[model samples]
Target chain A: EAGVAQSPRYKIIEKRQSVAFWCNPISGHATLYWYQQILGQGPKLLIQFQNNGVVDDSQLPKDRFSAERLKGVDSTLKIQPAKLEDSAVYLCASSSGLVFSYEQYFGPGTRLTVT
Target chain B: AQTVTQSQPEMSVQEAETVTLSCTYDTSESDYYLFWYKQPPSRQMILVIRQEAYKQQNATENRFSVNFQKAAKSFSLKISDSQLGDAAMYFCIWGANTPLVFGKGTRLSVIA
Candidate 1:
């Protein structure tokens, strides 16, 4: 089976610019997540989606950051008017479903460098 | 709210030796999951091992094993017969749903 797929492994943008990252999760997977990993820190959950609906996004910066899992197969994370503090690796992960305890499959994250 | 902690900022081990990474967590839920994820230079978070809180027997995968102490709220990873490829940042995580809480990872270096 194919692993989670992400586009534009590295991105560079100026502060206040808008940037978007895409993720295509493993086929048949029902849950998808987006996380941010700053240097010397662990990945922080940004948002989570179960199928086409969001499960949790309490930690997300709703003022600037937004994500959507359209059609429940692929998802996208966007940061409008990005800040310098947002310069970190954005990771995408997916799991099988709610009942099973399948391990999360992660993709090669998109490293966003805001100058 | 659940939180994971990894006090070790960095650790090193010799090839063929064993090294243990310590992790402690805080949670109120009786049923949850613990995980060890490895992130190498490629930047992909790979699942190394996982354990259910209710399970008594430790979970082991290949040369990797977990020492899960539910009472103490501690979970640690022990790597036996360490290899050069094992050198990476290992993150301990806990959660029940899509959002997982991770500890500050421990960077492990293996000497050849």
Candidate 2:
């Protein structure tokens, strides 16, 4: 089965510029997530959506980060007026949501660099 | 909030040898899932193995296995007969009703 898919495998932008990342989840998966991985740390969830509705986004930076899942299948994460500190690997993951364990399938992340 | 911790930042092993990475977590929930994910240089996080808190027997997947101690909130991954392909960043994660919380990750290197 095809795993979660993300676009723009790499991105470079200047501070205050706007950048967006897109994700296409595996068919039939009900849960989608966006995470940010700093150079030396594990990925942290930026937002989560269950089907078309958002489930959690407490960790998201409301001032600069935003994400949406349209039709519950494809999702997009955006960072407007980016800062140098925002440079990191943006990862997209999806899960079947059928069982408790909910094994997640990850996409090849989009590495973003804000200079 | 739940948190995962990987104490070892880096580990190295000779080819065909064994290496173990340590992880510990803090959580109030009794039953949840724990996972070990491998991220190669290519940067795709892949599931290496997983353990359910309710299961007493350790979860094993081929040469990769987990030692899960629920009472102590400790989980560790052991790679047996390690190969160069096993070199990657290993992350310990705690899964529950909320999004999975990940540790900083342990980078493993295999020397041939």
lDDT at A103 for candidate 1? 82
What do the candidate models score in CA lDDT, each in turn?
0.92, 0.92
- The pairs that clash in candidate 1 are none
Pairs that collide, model 2: none
Model 1 TM-score is 0.95
TM-score of 2: 0.96
TM-score on alpha carbons, each prediction: 0.95, 0.96
Off by over 4 Å in 2: A98-100
The runs of at least 3 residues in candidate 1 whose Cα sits more than 4 Å from the true structure, single-residue gaps closed, are none
Provide fnat values for all models in the order shown: 0.74, 0.77
